[model samples]
Every structure is written in C-alpha cells, then in structure tokens.
Target: MIPDPTVRLIGWAVTRTAEAIVDRAADRIATKMKTCIVMTVRHRAVAALPKRGRV
Candidate 1:
C-alpha cells in the first residue's frame, strides 16, 4: 500500500518506515501530520508556516 501525501510531506522517513514495517499505516499518517510542523520549525523550513496557515 502507498502512503498518503501527509506521510511523504512530513518526510520523517525513519519513523514512517518503522510504522510501515509494523503495518501501522494510520498511525504513521497521523504522526506525520502531527510532527511535520515541529520538524519543519526545527529544521528552519519556514515554508510550512504558509502551508499551515492555509490549512
């Protein structure tokens, strides 16, 4: 099964990959959406601020 946009966009591949390997797809998606904001901020990816504002 393919991951959704949320998973890919978040780019937390290690966590996502572990989840996938464990068949935790929904958990992976939710974790991605949840963590993306924090990770982007940590990485200084301000582009997410605009996207978050739009959302």
Candidate 2:
C-alpha cells in the first residue's frame, strides 16, 4: 500500500538530517585524532633533541 505524501516527505527529511549529523560527528572525531597524533609526534621529537649546555 502506498503511504501518504506528507509522511513520506517527513521520513525522507529525517533520514537526511540523521545522515548529516553523523557526517559532522565523524569529521569532528577525525580532526581530534589528527590533532592528538600531531601533538604526540611533536612531543617525541622535542624529547629527542639534545639538551643545551654541557659539552
């Protein structure tokens, strides 16, 4: 049986909204992970540098 036009439109809108929300959340997570990785790398590199003073 075919559903009402209004109901179908609402369902489609909800689906699209959910997808957009998910996409935004994933992007945020990826950005945070990237920042963490970069920070860790920088910290390790700094630690590896030779200390000043004392020959």
**Highest TM-score, which number?**
2
lDDT tens per residue, model 1, 15-46: 77877777777778889988997886777866
Off by over 4 Å in 2: 1-3
The candidate maximizing lDDT is 2
Which runs in model 1 stand beyond 4 Å of their true positions?
A: 1-23, 41-55
Error of 2 at 43 (Å): 0.4
* Candidate 1 TM-score, C-alpha based: 0.27
Worst 10 residues of 1 by lDDT: 46-55
Question: What is the model-wide C-alpha lDDT for candidate 1?
Answer: 0.75
